[model samples]
Target: MDKKAAKILMSTFWGGGGWKSVSTPFSGEDFEYAKSQGVMFDPLTITHDEIVQRLHEIHQDDTLQERVVTAFLHSLSTKKVHLRSALSSWALTSQLPLHTYLERRAVHANTSACGDCNFLRLQSDQEYVDADLNVLNFERIKWGGVRHGWLLYCLMDLELLYKDTDAISEVTPEDQAILVSLLEAAQTGDPKDSARSLEKRWKGLFPSSKQERDALLEIWAAAGLLVPTDKPRRGKGGSGDFIFVATWQGDDGYNTDAALRYFAPYLPEIL
Candidate 1:
């Protein structure tokens, strides 16, 4: 491994920000400093083949974490899953507590019980079954070989979703309008298009508060509806032009000026 890559990984691991916080692990200055030290590596410079090669190399270790990471990376790079659907599912399942079903059972029984007792007491009510299914789905993602970055991304998206719309059950007409407007804007294929620019253009359609609009933009990016522009020079500079990768280190802000492109291939289906 390159020493610079190792250094970057170490920094990312020890860094601070998380799904609950607005800040990122590394600030803009950190990227600048890394560049000055000749240690910054642009993710855009890496090709799919190179990524697969690296994954192959990492798979040699055969460790559980390595295997999980490799699988997650492969799925992401290959676009194996429908991002919009996956995000929606995550948002829905994440809202409920992991032990919601168990708690409901305990409440009904009106007694403290061991794990086996709780399992035996499980009811067949539709609501309980739905809650149990939600918990199961959440657990699968939480402990079933998914990457932490993706998990964090989902959590952050859910937080923003609640903050902006206050519900995850369904997409309202207004939400559909906003999504359509975004799709139309992206269809223009303008290289200068950024979240700030779009927010300005659709000011009437978005929330009045700047912070709320920013939250919505962040949620869109996390949902993979909006992605960093493919313009090579844009992401090359370690400045304010980067996408949210849900990683601890790196740019995490909405980056209103960072050009974004519509990437939801399933938008029409959803709309």
Candidate 2:
């Protein structure tokens, strides 16, 4: 594992900046709810670096390692990493067993972890789904690259697999219609068309409240499916928004074949 590459990928995968945890101080009702879950949760400032660092600490007791890895996986399942966009990075230190899990779960489709990125296959079991659960095709998912000693996703693009973390956990058929419309418009019009305009035109698909819309859009941006374009104004501030761009055939690098093979099924409707 390339430590240098790992750091770079971590920085990007975590969405830039250093590992900084912001505390979410639970209050009255929230605190009570947390206790019900068996943890007196006082969310603290914990960075990804800290988590990865703990993964490397080889103590005399292997129990500590197990606990750390377990906690890390739990975090992955529950917490939303910022800017976790279509691109992601994974560390390959001796202590972390994630590589083994990825290897075991990888759906090999005549691919390798060479060149720019590495790819993997995920299980379609709905009950035990991860962030990439909605993407039913194994070939569509590809990741590769070794920066320094760390494993990073390279030459890959985004595809809508998960609905994102929010109160709206599932993508209804209506939501699929919205996505289909967006994709159709993107394919025919100028590439520079404003996504904000599209949203405004399809206002009914989003929450009526501005605050809710902003929040939802932020989450969508982080998911890597939307690409933001800058629409410059005359001696004024720039405007525009990210649109749905990454599809089954958009990515041209390491996983083109896989993307082509699998992304086709999602056309005209999002599952």
The model with the greatest TM-score is 2
Residue 102 displacement (Å), model 2: 26
TM-score of 2: 0.33
Cα deviation at 151, candidate 2, in Å, is: 18
Model 2, 47-147: lDDT tens digits are: 22333333334333444323322222222223322212222211123323323322333344323322111232111111221222111111111111112
RMSD for each of the candidates: 22.0, 16.3
| Stretches of model 1 off by over 4 angstroms after superposition | 1-170, 235-271
lDDT of 2 at 251: 18
Where is model 1 poorest over a 10-residue stretch in terms of lDDT?
126-135
Name the 10 consecutive residues with the lowest summed lDDT in model 2.
134-143
Q: After TM-score superposition, what is the CA distance of residue 11 in candidate 2 from its true location, in Å?
A: 34
| TM-score for each model | 0.31, 0.33
Question: Among these predicted structures, which one has the highest lDDT?
Answer: 1
Q: Tell me the whole-model lDDT of each prediction, alpha carbons only.
A: 0.33, 0.29
